[model samples]
Target: MNKNKNQYINREISWLSFNERVLQETADVNVPLIERMRFLGIFSNNLDEFFKVRYATVKRIVDAGKTGKSVLGGEKAKDILEEITTIVIKQQSKSLEILGAIEKELETENIFIIDENEVTDTQAVFLKSYFMQKVSPGLLTIILNDLREFPLLKDTAAYLAVKMVLINEVDGNENKENKYALIEIPKDIDRFVVLPNEGDKNYIILLDDLIRYSLRHIFTMFTFESISAHMIKITRDAELDMDNDLSKSFIEKISSSVEHRKISDPVRFVYDKNIADDTLSFLMDKMGIEETDSKIPGGKYHNRRDYMKFPSLGRKDLMYSKIDPLPVKDFSFEGSILEQIAQKDYLQYTPYHSFSYITKFLREAALDPQVRTIKLTVYRLASNSQVASSLINAAKNGKQVTVQIELQARFDEQANIEYAEQMQAEGVKLIFGVPGLKVHSKICVIEREENDKIKRYGFISTGNFNESTAKIYTDYTLFTAYSPLLKELNKVFDFFETTYKINKYKHLVVSPHYTKNVFIGLIDQEIKNAREGKDAFIKIKMNSFTSYKMVDKLYEASNAGVKIQLIVRGICCLVPGVKGMSENIEAISVVDKFLEHTRVFIFGNNGNSKVYISSADWMTRNLDFRVEVGCPIYDEDIKQELVDTFEISWNDNVKARMFSEQQDNAYRKNDKPKLRSQFAVYEYYQKKLNA
Candidate 1:
């Protein structure tokens, strides 16, 4: 199957297809009812990103004609744009069908999503009270007829496009023209307006319903014969451009870019186009949204991501019960984490195990009198980050804290900038990233003065050190005080200070130079073993596997009879399980309660196995452009744990989707016992803790 004439599927188009798989989750009847609703939230969130980034890029391409092809990865910008619109239209239709199915299922459970018209007398009174007390204060209604200048609509916020027919004559049949107005749904208020329950039946009203109920009050001055409203939302370009002005601080440049993002041109204009032409035209004309923008026909409600926080209504049956994170077996809270690392390396499996170990280690470092210096890289951090707090504490206690915080972590520019400022004010030395490269590596090194020598203790991770995200994002954190590894890591920090001076690494695989070659060499080793008739295999679990070079290499290894298994959670361009080409290759994607965010690679070299946990996926950008780190799991126990996790995921028959070129998103089938990897992973860690 030569898909090469297609060269490569447009990244944006492929991303939309990936989202279609998510939408499939909502449509799948096998999925639990409440979980299906949450899938809707995931779908909405995905579309918001599609518009902000992918669609925005396409829009830029369409505007810039010929030059757009290079940016779009071999596809013409216009061709990609047309393809995305067609695909999105189909996906939207599918979404509606999914919603209809979900609504029907909700009815079976006695959970009715009541609209404004369906509300009874008692419910209306409660809803009215809710409107007054909760939503009214935050509502911004723009009188379209009166305003001199059009209001600048905030991207991602839903607005009600209102049409009112003024009662001009006594006769009800008199020809009266309609007036248009706009009301932005207050994002601060809960989108779900829970109504009083009637015995066993649960009732809920959407925030849109409340707004629909209170529409007359919003426009009391203008008399109308008839009124109608529909939800509309616009998504704008989110790409930030860095200024080359050396005088301005990095934080200032990011802040300015964020401000610029607010007024960025609309990429997609999604509306309940059941709206009258006059109303649509009035809003479109005022918003300056032209035909070039992708105008999508959508349902009455937009921004369904609000449903992610959908109130459980104390219904325990409707929600997944919280799983308590188990403690890591080898690493304990009693003694110094550094001391344990000093003896041998340890692995931390987050979400399955408490992420507090990372925090505790840093806190220990901050308090340890012998510790003189600490260095780390920050990409995306939590709002109230314990990592930042710990680093600041270290700086306060006379420890030299060096942080290379990336100011351009997408959607997190403002947060990282704020963090950089806070860390700088606390006397923590800040490196505003290498001139052009984004520091995507997650590494921390603490230098402790012990026995007349400085010994380094730190952890390298495949995920960020954000505690809040650690609860839901499955990631690996490798803790080690191995002198060789630490020395190489210290060199990585030094490279950030001195970008022109590139250093060779012996242990750790540093990206932008060594990562690609190192990975290729390892894969070649497996291939060589397969050629020699030795037991050879490769297992990788990553967020995405889109690099063509890596794909081709894997394909070659597969043809050579090397067993290849991949558990990619998102974006897999390489189709697995073809007859001759990839008969030895198998790929599955697991999407469950926790996001499978960890990147693990296992290579079988003869009888010995080498496992690695990396911050980078097998993506070209990660390998060639970004500063990523892939560290070997030298600790035997940790390597075994990673192997076990990969196996558990590989064995997953439930919640694992088979990835094919067909894009069916079919569930992996097996006669074996049901295995959901996320659940199995948790159980495995729990058992480890108990043992």
Candidate 2:
């Protein structure tokens, strides 16, 4: 360990622990059965990305032969990797047990998930016909015995490793045992094949099982004694490597990098635990997998992420009841969202409030002839995004549309690139982003010719401008006509265009330069308040908090008797409640139905509360490398709303987990009203709308 680091947990390990909190949802009896299965899927999906980004980075350090202890929270990269593997194996085992329990519970509900062997005669006939029609043409099989080299397995796609004992007759020789083959699962087809519903009972088969059932039909050319297939998946390092070739455009560089990602170094190789020993050995040898690489022996299925898209089968009884998004009480869609914002700032808390306001705002901007220019920064957008369409509409209507679409937003890179090209073709001035910094700020500003002069109406959001995610991700968006703030937002758009110039911002805390210093200053104020015996408290809610500098600053404040509270949904490195270092600090994570994606910060400035909603977590990458925006809530009502919402999440007993040295992900329970904040928050908004 370096520098005697005691107060901060490793971010990677902390993240794994946070995912355990998600796994906890899978085992929570209070959760609906189908939802629990979906929770497992979420857990799996989260882990896949963690390995691709975090684990791959650590492995890079190990490959570079650096101890990397300083950056990796006082642990060697290799040590952290080993620890991660051990924890993952344990978690994976636990998840399997939870999955089994879910299946049994599902069986009670008359939902049967049948395997190939368990298929009924009538069901087998239907599956055969379905396979011949739907799955046959799409299937790509490679006979491995005669191939010169092993094919490069896809990054996250599942495959079947087959073994056959072929009858070899060479010079009257009887049999030659082992022949291997690989089958790449088609990405276009759905993973779950739902059979015809039998009265009230539901029968579904996995895609892999369907393939297994049709193995003979797939390989009619080869004569074999027996053949078997077990799912195998390779997870490649998804880090993009951009070449410094000046001849290539940014889009070309990104496109090439995305193509290169298909055959990157394999970070993980998961296979069925029951796979034949010879088959596993042969495949491992061909792939050159080593002990350093993660080789997890898994269940029958490898990509359990498909569970996320599980068929609902009209079983509303097995799912959480849907709540209609309420209208923001004072803000009406009958009038322009812009017109209302001009009067007073209104906050839109998503999933609780309809996301249509954002679209309506954009649509209004697109159609309003007076609107001359529209500018925005996008990080992640939805498939078939109306946000992009609105911008395209603005461009088509002769409006000067400028957009900073981030092409490096991880898995969404391809989608963003396609959108960028489409928008560019439509004459929207597309900005790939700042040269080195990804523009992660979720903001949009439009200038309208009101009364023969320019007036701006815009919104700053804690989440993406994407409408699809807005329905599931808990976030905060402030709709305002504040000229000064809009001017600063205009500066952000300018920063994207002019990289050499660093713009100063007074209201919005911009990152890659300002957010860290500004936040530290905020903590320093709290510390000074505590020293002077004035009321001092700092509260925050974010997805993750792993910046050691931020942690040390909070520790310094906590030691000075400043009260600090954190409602982190994932990866909290600051170990709260330490005797001297952080006794005044407390942290809890709330994992529920809706993802807690909002970033809110509050400071008790001598009885008056200062609040902000941000796009950035306290992670190092977000603070030091990305262009994130943290907007202060100047409106007192919205400030109180944020404070109230934070309190609700902080008081959660049903789904909140405490953060401590143990890292056990223990649920925070109390003898109060069972406040499930995700549900409570919806009701809170509903009542506000009613009142």
Candidate 1: list runs displaced more than 4 Å. Answer: 1-9, 28-31, 67-74, 146-148, 169-175
lDDT on C-alpha atoms for all candidate structures: 0.85, 0.91
10 residues in a row with least lDDT, candidate 2: 1-10
Can you write out model 2's per-residue Cα lDDT over 496-586, one digit (the tens) per residue? 8888889999899999999999999999999999999999999999999999999999989988889999999999999988887888999
Relative to the true structure, candidate 1 reaches a TM of 0.95
User: Superposing every Cα of model 2 onto the true structure, what RMSD results?
Assistant: 1.6
All predictions: root-mean-square deviation over Cα?
2.3, 1.6
lDDT top scorer: 2
Question: Top TM-score: which candidate number?
Answer: 2
Candidate 2, pairs of clashing residues: none
